[model samples]
Target: MQLLIVTAHPETQSFNFAMRERAATVAARVGAGLSFSDLYQQGFAPTPGRADFQDFPATQSFDLAQAQKAHQQHGGFALDIQAEQEKLEQADAVILQFPLWWGGYPAVLKGWIERVLSYGFAYGRDKTLPAKKVLLAVTTGGIADEQDAQRSQARLQAMADDVFGYMGWRILGLHLVHGPADLDAEQRAEALNSYAERLRLWLSEAVPLAA
Candidate 1:
């Protein structure tokens, strides 16, 4: 299996990064080809602009769809965006690892989605990306409670129904690791281990797309 892990955390030693490392290790153990994009470490640009396209006219009003389509047709996307597109195309599964900030994706990650998953590559009238399994590994500092769990579930559902599902991707799992801020060292280790095992199990199984 080919797996692509995209991590958007800034601190390499944080729990989010630890989860990413564990994912890499598990991918190696399962003999899955692994590719990664460390958004913060790579200094990924989060804002989309004219710089993303080549030969885009200076006078015309910026139209994302038009720019993306023109750039894709003429091989005009920035190198970084092109590289990410290639990785996404080659992967059978994708894992998004990050700490949930304000109940949503980090700015850089959101930017990555906007720029790399462009018109004609990710979605368009005649072009939609092939279905692939996707997993969201979200970390939260707050303790898991009934209310928080409900909110998280709602958010995940929205993402599934509105984002990934709309884009023709299958949602395999939404793993949330909560209360890392209050856990002791042993508890934290156990939490990480349990999540890692869950991820391994999910990756080992064949999950059909939801109808």
Candidate 2:
């Protein structure tokens, strides 16, 4: 099995980093080929526009979707965008890891999707990418039961439904690690171990780790 993990966080030493590493460990145990895209480390461009397109006319109005569609036909998306698309195309499952920023995906991750998941590739075709499972593994600013965490989970689920679900992919699960940064060393390790166990089920065993 092939698993693709995309992480968006600025600090290399942050808990989000550890989270992805924990995921990798599970991927390894499960014997899945792991593909990682660390946005900041890649210096990925977060904006989508004419620069990302190849054949679109500069003089014409730039419609993001139309431009993406054009690239699907003419084949001119930037190298970085193409690389990310390739990873997603190969993944049997995908995990998006990042902190819950403003109750949504970090702009970098959102832009990565926008620039990479082009038209016809993400939708508007008979067989886009095969139906793969997607998991939303996010870190929260507070405990999961906090009002904010509840709302964030709802919003993230809605996003998964509209984006991945609409693309015909299954939503595997959403793992929320609350206040990871605030945890003591022992607590943090315990949380990571718990996450690893869940990852073991989700990525390796193809089972949803019940919340």
Candidate 3:
């Protein structure tokens, strides 16, 4: 099996970094090959421009044929879009790992998605990519206890559904291990163990992790 991991942490020392490490380690142990895209370290640009939409064939609407023609034009937009598409094609599973910032994904990661998951690709709906293979491996500094409160749980679940589920990816699960700012040794171990176990379970089961 092959897994694609896209990480959006700006710092190498962050818990988001550790989550990628743990995920890669577990996947390797299970005989899964890995490919990673580190957005911040690679300095991926998120801002979209006319060039991103350039060579976009004149069409009545955003349709598959227009997108295909645009993709055929080899240039800045096509190159970057092809790179992401290649990664997605090469992997059996895709994992997005990022720290939850301001109750959502980092802007860089969001930009990567916007740039890469173009029309006629990830979700043209009619031309959508196969959804079951994609999953998420998210890390957050917020404590799990905080997520357990009724309002917080509802909000987070909605976030997950809208981001992953709505986008057609089956959310494998979230690694919302908490307190990076104040983690004790025990807490750290507990978090690692939980992450590893969940990783194993996801690999073992063929079913989607979302409800």
On residues 1-211, what C-alpha lDDT tens digit does candidate 3 reach at each position?
8789999989988777887898888888777888999989988887654445546655446554454535644433556656777888777787788776777778998887777766556666454456646556565555546445444445556776875677677766655555565888788777877888888788766534333
Model 1 lDDT tens row, 38-147: 99999999899898976677998998878898777778888889889889988999999988788788899999988988888787776546767999998876855799
Please, what are the lDDT tens digits per residue for candidate 2 over residues 83-184? 998898899899999888877889999898788877877777733656778888898788545686678778889988978888888888998888887899
lDDT for 129 in candidate 3 is 58
RMSD of each: 3.6, 3.2, 4.9
Is candidate 1 or 2 superior in TM-score? 1
For TM-score, the strongest prediction is 1
lDDT (C-alpha) at residue 164 in model 1: 80
> How much lDDT does each candidate structure score?
0.84, 0.84, 0.69
lDDT score of residue 135 within candidate 2 = 88
Ranking by TM-score: 1, 2, 3
Question: Which regions of candidate 2 fall more than 4 Å away from where they truly are?
Answer: 144-148, 207-211
- Clashing residue pairs found in predicted model 3: none
In model 3, the Cα lDDT at residue 207 comes to 30
Candidate 3 root-mean-square deviation in Å:
4.9
